[model samples]
Target: MSRSTSTPAAPATPTTPATHGPVRIGAQARTAQRPTVDPVVSGGFWYDRRRTVARVAIPQGPGLLESAGNLHDLRLAAGAADGPFRGDYPFMDSDVYKWLEAASWQLGQAPDGEHGAAAEASLAEHMEKIIALVADAQQPDGYLNSWFQSGKGDGPFLDLRWGHELYCAGHLIQAAVAHHRATGADSLLQVARRFADHIDATFGTPDSGKPVDGIDGHPEVETALVELYRETGERRYLDLAGYFVDRFGHGRLGGERYCQDRVPLRQADNVEGHAVRQLYLLAAAADLATETGDDELGAAAARLWHAMVATKTHLTGGVGAHHDEEDFGDPYELPNERAYCETCAAIASIQFSWRMALLTGQARYSDLIERTLFNGFLAGMSLDGERWLYVNPLQVRDGHTDTGDDQSARRTRWFRCACCPPNVMRLLASLEHYVSASDGSGLHLHQYVSGRYRGETDRGLPIFVNVNTDYPWQGRITVTVEECPDMPWTLSLRIPQWCRDYTLSVDGVPSARTQNEAPAQDGWLRVERVWTAGDALVLDLDLPVRLVEADPRVDAVRGCVAIERGPLVYCVEQVDHPGGGLDDVVLDPSRPLSAKDRPDLLGGVVTVVGAGYRRRLAPSGWWPYQDRTDAERGDHASPVGTGEPVELTAVPYYAWANREDGSMRVWLPTD
Candidate 1:
């Protein structure tokens, strides 16, 4: 790969810079506070993706909404253009809300530069149309729900299990906040606030006179309310978020992990319930903890994080072990072929990890974010950026079919539930938020993507850091400080856990290390100094193909090995195998693996190849698993067949199914 370096361009108005304060929502107030660079302003890796979202995804989103009936439902509720509500089942409104959120972010990317000016303007118009529909659909008293309004007359907040009313509200509140942040438009915010107020008045303590308690069957409103509180600085919204979290586990919703109401947020140690719900709830709790300085909530979130990393998480950082309830399974119960690592769950995991990283300023959290983003999350969306995968399993067997219309051997543009698509759109739109963060003390580069970070330090110092690299594809990163404070400030660059050895240089000379062996500090290579414009730092990271084995407790992959190169976990897709299928492929772990850049395949990737073996066909009519007598069997007494050696090709796990629809395997049997 060719090396690239970036420098700040002529200054322009940047998107709203988020700083850690006594009141913030997503990231915790870092002692050394930092702000996220706007995706529009963040050129390179983020710019490419965001522009795709703006020009392609955002443009395509409305049609999907219209065709899916999200808008039809809203139209019916608004009494405008409709008969009965249209698509997305009972929770269609949430999809619209999520799309609105994506559009808002796309609009925010507008002022960054003139990269996609025409698309940006078009996106704004589309957002207005959607926002108007959402506002019109909302009832006179702030109640919104096309299903409840258009269906047989019934009041809201009745059923928590599958109602998703508050869930929809939560998404609306989030969209409203994003809209306000991106466009300085308060229209959506006003709608969200009104709906939130109604929720507060309707549900609360016994003295509050509400039919149902503060909890929702799905846990989203809690986090969204906190976001609303952050935007408006309203104490009531913040308190309402706390109430929902604290009120759960009272046994009113039944003791089940499916909905995560089994116990209070503060007491729950491991992740449970629907994967997306669990991560969303945990992310909200983390936000609440940061906003309120609630030690108990923070501690509980930490415990859940530990539990997930230790057991339920996949090699690609995807979570949720089972396809049945979409909930977690037993520890180390990770099964590749039967995996239910939903795309939404992977997105949720990134959200949760981002919050934890922001709240704690820990590199480990960012590490998880990097792994998930490159592998599971990015894998959901194809290279061309249209098709999507709802569930990203590591291995796909021959003759396998998508049973519940959930799993697929390949990507689809939409689904009946259709949650992942919009969810992905919003995340891709707001991806700049996760790239780099600033704390009171310094700036921390979390996920490595070629981009320019323009923001100020917590102490009010203007700085612009421009990074250039073909990261994941390339390990070398060159970060240039285009602008900075004259005084000494810390610059922390994350050294990913996968990279064992790295070399860092300041200016043109290698910095002498102290007795500590390296300038290693807090999971980062810390460089604190008085800096000037044009000062450059180059860090060379190691990228080698590695064979990884699962924990002994993970029975599904015992004696099997998975291929990994840097942060990306590799899989053997059938498209790469013309001689045989993945099921017949066996790897020799001890063999040296070589990585070759395949510029023509899968939008350009470093493909890992190694000497392996393919199983030969057994004799026809041969009885398998039948014991043969020593005298009768003679030379055929052995139970297993030793196959002939063959060369195997492996691509990134996320990049699988983007090609031909056939067998794919991450963990291959090894001799």
Candidate 2:
């Protein structure tokens, strides 16, 4: 399991399927053709460059990488032959292995010293140590896992629903693939294959005499197996992956008792259930369709994407409606106060959206990613980037303190299951991968952050893009293109869904075209003249304050509304109004809210000021159903609510909890 510093071997060529199996309900069976890797995974801006720079700016930067690197080093320290896992925390130990594997694949894609050789070595050592631990704990039948292995005598596979046996296997398979790809080593791959083969042999066959339940409590294995099939080109792996997907909604898989069981996978109208698990399953299904050429599966994924965006999604592109269930609420039932936007869910949603964008060539998918990245994803980490918010609520009640019982529904330093911290670190460390993508014909500019990109277009033309702009804070983006080949190539600039109006400029010439303009003649802006290094394009999107109200169906807020600018949802904190309750808050949509730049606040957030009323106690006289009530209850007074005019300020919901520990609410009742 321990990997050497030597370079990894070339990726193995995919094999042709000798025999074919019947396609299960949701399964995409492989034929004779070999499966290819997703272009998104193979080529993208590296994560280390795009996400890590911002991450290291936070307070916990040292511990973030230290923990991850330590985990990685432990594996390498243990030879591929044998070593101990050597970690006090079992969950962290497991995650360290996962990160090592993911990091390995990234390193293999572009092995350079920029990522730090020492860091890489440490990761390899940790991986090796964990593999040795796995080997020592593995059962004779090829089952491997420390937690499950230890509990075998009393109850082996007794609680597959919550135990996460398959989930661990999925991570193992992922790490194995990543390490093999990065180091060209087979020791870990061999171990992964044995475990995978055992899983395929143990689960899901009418004749195997094992349980026929096709679903996993955690939906990761489906995606992992699909990746394995892509890497190995083995038909069996693809079949098994498909089987998991198909078995997902059928009664044979024990129905949707856990999550999403009420409806079949293909028939499910929206993204629901555990936030992370649902998105992972969707991503895997998308990969399966691409790998197996299953049009039906692809259509299902597309429908799900649209449904999520249209109904379940927030203005910031965050999903997962209710904090209580950590699941989807009724369509358009988005309540800011009760919103439980888990950090992991946002990451998974972005992954799923990115995959969809790749498959369909739609800018909307990328648009969603941009929204989530700027808002929901950004909210996951504190301004300093050290502390993390497990649950990102749309609204925080002013003066309200969260009790420990609702930790999952609030932000915290750490959790008993501290998966998000490291996960956030790794994601941030590798954010560059999500920026722009090339399809050979043209380059797709998904996000508008200031940066430079050098990559080959799908047509193999060397393309260089240097973008300069202040994004999220400002809407101006200047993109310079160079190295155009003899043949004309198109460049697709994403027009964000939120951008009601935008101006386009080519080579410094302002075009009259706006968002309403017709699609470019060639399905892309045509630059007939031979392009030079200085060729430039400028885009300006209007980022203005916009009022947002929840659907009438959401019972939590019958007559309330929230505000948003760009992708951030705004909230009114009690700190802004010392004694005035949010209930006294009301927005006069007619009176436009002004946006003022306040750099003094977290990350230069935009503040919106408006006129509203402050609630005050009022005296009331008792009334009776009959006309004589005034005399019968003479001089009797009761407390009644009254409002006084006041000025209110609102900040982004993501920035609320970062300020003074006071209550905040997103939705304010209007009188």
Q: Largest TM-score belongs to which candidate?
A: 1
RMSD in angstroms, all models?
3.6, 7.9
Each prediction's number of clashing residue pairs? 10, 36
Lowest-sum lDDT 10-residue window in model 1: 8-17
Residue 32, candidate 1: Cα error in Å is 7.1
Per-residue CA lDDT of model 1 for 124-181, tens digit only, reads 8888888888889888888888888887335577766677889999999989988998
Model 2 weakest lDDT span, ten residues long: 30-39
For model 2, residues 124-216, the per-residue Cα lDDT tens digits are 565566556555555667666554333222344566555566776777787777667657787777777887888888787677586644566
Q: lDDT values of the candidates?
A: 0.78, 0.61
